[model samples]
Target: MAKLFLLLFTLLNSSFLFSQENTLGNEYCQIQLISTEKSPSVNPPIKNLDKEQVTLLEIPAGKSRLRLNCRLDEQGVFTFGNDEILDVSWEALEVKLVPLAASSPSFLLPTGTFSIDFVFLTHHNYKQNFVWEPIVTFLNASLLNNITMGVFYGLCLTLILYVFFMGRVVGDTRFQFYSLYVFCAATFFLLQEGQLNIFLQQQSFLLSHQFYLLFAGFTVFTAIVFIVRLTDLNTTWPKLTRYGLEFGAVVVLLMSVLMLFLNHNELSALLGSAMARVTLLLMLGILTLVSIQAYRNVQSAKLVLLSLVLMVIAMVFRTVLHDVNPFLQRYSLIIAFAVEAFMLAVAVSERIKSIQTDKILAESQANTDALCNVLNRRGWDKKVNEILSEQKIKGGVICLLYIDLDNFKQINDKWGHDTGDKVLKVVSDIIRNQLRSIDSIGRVGGDEFVALGIFYDRTEAENLVIRIQKRLQAVSLHIDKQKTVEVSASVGHVIYEEPPKGAEVMLSQADQSMYQIKRASKQG
Candidate 1:
């Protein structure tokens, strides 16, 4: 039983090895090429001959038509010396070939000799190599290409959706322009890579080529707009921004007109690519300059600068290093673009944060007194209104001390405005020091100030008022080496068990009491 089992296992292993060898042999086939002076539609001279009569032919450059003889044991897909792939029918005696354009011819084959006539739409200066493989190999290659293209498009679409929603949320035109730029860029790449051809089965080669140029033009145009808006280039780099915008607009217009009117030819394609590249360089230069100028003041500009630099490096690598690995060359731009989009998103978020901070600071400045760096009348009114509202709910005793500097005009006239300003700052500091953190103080007039605080009773309010008066009396300002100015203040106190209905009404009542004390002091 053991010997029989070993014998069966050995036979099975041998069979498997033999099958693998046969499969590999069938997968790879030999092809021979013969250039002919005859037109692509004409049959070559060696069709009726046996396999020995067919000589090994070398395919030379710049020839329009060639005869390709390939031997196959089974049906297979074959790629010609050019990049064109076609399906072969074993049963059909004659094969029909199609060319890229009207002037080109199709690759047609006859079954018996295993021979086909190949045509070229464009002449190449280098030698041509043909690929012959089983149909399964072709399918595998197609699947791989589909996966790569799908990943690229997926990333681009995600960025588009993200930026589109963010643009609407932030109400920023720059984000909108960036999203448009990304869409155009993705479309351009899809057309360039031939991924769109798979989906648009009815699209003609001419229309596809034209759409590629159109999207490329718009990509550069929108990128310029995005950078200009992001950096405020019109205001910061006026001359450069003006020139960049004009150049980008001209390039886009030329591409659009060319796509509509011009014939699809090598010359037109070259011109379109050249114009697009030049516009990209111009945009990069403008962004680099703007970033350098603004980076010191704007933190977000640093990220923008880094993204631009990364993109420029990727572009340079793709253009200059043509001999690099094919897979790396194909994906370098996609990777660079993804990194750049992420950085730009971060920069936009940072810009929004900065704007919010500036708004808060501006509000604070509007309500603050510039001279004393304390609350102005407007700020004090708002603060008192908040307090009054709170007191209405939780009724408590509140005290308002209205204080006025006596003979302030006389002191200002004698010592000059500079010394008068210094004296006011001293008074403001003294008032701030005397008040609790919860209390509020404001400058309502040139020489009048108000202090608001919570007190338990009339005795506590009177004690607080006396303390403030004593501090004001002790304050003195030195105007010069020869002179010192001293000032006195008249105080009026208003105590409320329940706060007034409005901050304005409370201020009015306090002002009247202050004037009564001022008049009585003048009489004394």
Candidate 2:
């Protein structure tokens, strides 16, 4: 706990990041777990209010309804049935809550504790809503809450669509998981807003708040999978860590299924202490992984970890860490979710760049020569053709050189293949070093090499050929402490002002020129 606080303190001081959705009671509203049982209260007490139990008249047996002992500090009217529970969820009210109904009923009672059974709506008015109906899940407290929720929902939706389409364009499933998480996260928060009851008041699943919880389970699942995929955690994590995560996932799935059958209290237990602890541990575990990856300088991890930490902190303070400021509780998730969306977008962009980089590297490796570290025949031909095409467009000439090492086989026989191999390496280095970096070279055959370069004209082309020949002739190989052999090459050159049919024809002419040079050397 100390370490967590220390880390959070340091990070919070330095940077800011992402957000998510939730329930505790969920985020935007608290569903009053209304019950008719003559049993012990299942509701955790809202802070700053005294507790005293009162029984209502209407019941199957001597069953009683739980009445909250409360008083409002500031005078204000509270509505029922339309958007009420959330804004006042943090505010301890001073009125006895009873099962009654009216079209967005308002409570404008004077402040007092443990006194009056405030008349909310007439008993005759509750006739249609006495059984099997969601009494009041939402309350409209203020427009600020409304605006806050609107902004939160909008940000979540925008990020969701952005990441989803990016995944499609890039053809990477990692982005898809992230996008799903964004949506799950947003929808989970929406569940807490009690808007679901507005649309599905008749549906038991929504009224029971099980559907809200089901999405909570989904949020956990998606968050887990998203991190796993993003960090490649399965491969990177130790076996025990991996198993723990897997186990957590199974727990979430089981819990989700349980939400379907459990009553409000049972579901609350499922989402309450035990589940919150499990979720906290899961979040900490993921944070640990992101930390390790960030340590290794994994860029995506670094980018996401910054934002993810804020979200975890917001969730912890909102859920498990009690007695916090009401203001922090209200806006923490909002800030966290918005910033998290931004970071996720940043992380997704980095992933796309990484994919592109890997692809280009793969293509380069496919076309490269293993021994020479330059282009092989296939790569050389393609590059030379591109250069030639550019030269044709720009109205310039290109030089092609066909170089054949003189008496290369004789040198191999006298000096052994080891020296011959060394000679080949040195020869390739010499030719490559003498040419422009953009020029193309390839080992065409045994002791045969080719090169192509852009030139101002035939004069510049011929001059470069002379320089290459001189550089090659200046080489000497030492076979022993006292023994040496000379290295030389016969060069054939072609300068093309007009575009050739292809690289093959240019190479053929250069080869013919080289053979002529060899024949002349023999006569001389």
Candidate 3:
């Protein structure tokens, strides 16, 4: 009984203090008129900055009972200037203070009771304190809300566009996935920040709360999945990352459903807020580590780091300063999230480029002959055209050669094609060993071969041919009857200032020259 009495006494004292603070004994205007411009990106009335005076309410001096003074700054923020701390330059103004009562009385001062229509009468209970009111039309609340929503819309759109462009350019699966996830997150954030649920024609408490619960839950889950994929964490720490993601998803999903059934509204709200903060912190830690690891080793890892930094900054503004100024707080998060999305998109693009490079290398190796480890005919043709196109600007000369084994058929008929193949392999090896790195060789036919090189003069080209022939002679062969088999080549060469109109033209020229060499050797 004593404890209950003490608690009651304490409550009474607190109530007394609150009542004293809210008292309005003598009817005097304690006016707090605020005039501020909508920050940006919305449908807002253009504030006439030049208008230094505000005609709040017109009334005859003799009929006015109370007065309060205020002034507008350059940015249009109004400050109370009736007190001693008069920071703003006050402009003399008249205003009407109407009462909402039926009794009317007259006095020396403008003290006659006036009547006005009463609107919403909000009351705050002691236990559940209400800090804000539903905006009144007289306060330009709609305009401010519109401006705030507009900024979020523009920011989200920008982020989506950036993510798409970066994903396309990078061509990486992870980056594309990152872009997609960011786009979804931005869309969800835009909806939540805009408070659009309040404006729905058929708004219901259940539907509104459910939408927010699902949207937030899915956003958190999606962000986690995207980060894991983007950082290749699943590959690096497959077991842990995979299990954690799955566990988190399941927990959030269950909580989402539970919130719908919960009787404790405040408890549900607190839990949701706590979970959101925890998820955000965990994501930040994981992303930070991944980004740092990437930056330490990979050339393209900076994009991830940049994205992480941007996200952290955005969350700071959103989680920390949400109540300061709706415009600044909201825009800061929007811009930061958009920037982070762009960076992640860049990271994804780099991954795509790496994949493409690997593909090209694999293709090149595939088209090469394993025996000689040189390009086969197909490879040669592809590389030659590509090289030609690349060097066209430099305007260089090229020498093409066709070399045929003089008695290659006889060797194969006497000894098997296996021996012949060995001989061909040896010859290909020796030719390759003697040629410069810039030169290319291809086995175009059974006994015919093609060589390509950039040359300054015919002397240099002929010298290369002589070197190949000498090396071929030095290479020994094994036959059934003899320890050695003689091998020689009939060589033909052609020079082109530019690539031939057709490959056939170059081949014909080289073939004719090879026949001429054969005839000359026969005559000798």
Point to the candidate with the largest TM-score: 1
* Error of model 2, residue 417, in angstroms: 3.6
Tell me the tens digit of each residue's lDDT in model 3 across 467-523: 765665434556555648788888788877775665667778988988898899889
Q: Which candidate order results from sorting by lDDT in descending order?
A: 1, 2, 3
> Candidate 2: worst 10 consecutive residues by lDDT?
123-132
What count of clashes does model 1 give?
A: 2
Instruction: For each candidate, give its TM-score against the true structure.
Output: 0.68, 0.65, 0.50
Could you give the candidate ranking by TM-score, starting with the highest?
Answer: 1, 2, 3
What is the C-alpha lDDT profile of model 1 across 1-524, one tens digit per residue? 99999999999999999997886454323443344333334433542212212222233323345555554455555443222111112222355432222111112222233555454433223333344444466567667867877887888898788877877876777788878888888877766666544444433653344565677677777777777777676677688677767466667757655765665355665666577668777766766776775656655667777888887777766655534544454567777877887788777777766766787799889888898888899899888887787778877778888989899999889888888888888788888898888888889999888999876677877788888978876456665566677988887878888767778888898899889988998999
TM-score of 1: 0.68
- Please give, for residues 1-524, the per-residue lDDT of candidate 2 as tens digits: 99999999888765532221221112111123233344435453322221111111222222223233333332323333321111112123434444222223334433433322222211111111111111122233334566677788888888888888888887988888888888887887776654444455433455344566677788888888877777777777757455887578658756766757754453445354465578778888888888898899876888779888889888766544524554565457768878887887888888888888898898888777766666777787788779877986887788999999999999889888878877777788889998987777888777888888887778888888999978875578665456587898998888888888888888899999999998998899
Once superposed on the true structure, which residue ranges of model 1 sit more than 4 Å away at CA?
Answer: 1-5, 8-12, 29-176, 186-207, 257-271, 280-284, 287-302, 350-354, 381-400, 452-470, 477-484, 493-501
